[model samples]
Target: MNTIEPRSTPQPHLTLAQADHQDTLRNCVRRSLNEYFRNLEGEAPNDLYPMVLAEMEIPLLEKVLEYTRGNQTKAAEMLGLNRGTLRKKLKQYGLL
Candidate 1:
């Protein structure tokens, strides 16, 4: 007897606009990183991962909150974050 394996869920499909938005974001990050490295002036980078995340997360949370009209639930849902986590981030960023 052969055992059946469970199939993995299919990835969500992105619309044209979504794809373009992703590409635009990628280009922006690439350009920013290139500029950042150039301006490093032979100094070693430090805490780059957190730095990039903080930089991106601020604008992302702000835009999502604005789009959701200050509704934490909707903003968290859109950002794939828990409502409590969103609130914590808002407080951390002084956006609360």
Candidate 2:
């Protein structure tokens, strides 16, 4: 079977007025993290790495698999993960 290529990263097509907001992904991440840290109110945060990855990874995998139309190999290549690793994650997420 021919493999479906993953879609290219989305490009913004905003008007001049909309562009002024500067709502890019980097800014969004920065804003979100800043808000998260601010909400902690001086409490020491622990396991942030795993926490962040766990939060992001599921949606990342879901989007990639959806882009690849449920094809494991192409999704793996697109994600820069080995096929087995991708399969494991997919299985873990109940996608497979």
Query: Which candidate comes out best when scored by lDDT?
Result: 1
* lDDT (0 to 1) per candidate: 0.90, 0.84
Query: Can you give the lDDT of residue 52 in candidate 2?
Result: 74
Model 1, 1-84: lDDT tens per residue? 999986987868988766655657886897799899999999999999999999999999999989999999999999898999
In model 1, residue pairs whose N, Cα or C atoms come closer than 3 Å (at least 3 residues apart or on different chains), thus clashing, are: none
Candidate 2 lDDT (Cα, 0 to 1): 0.84
CA deviation > 4 Å runs, candidate 1: 1-23
Point to the candidate with the largest TM-score.
1
TM-score of each: 0.74, 0.66
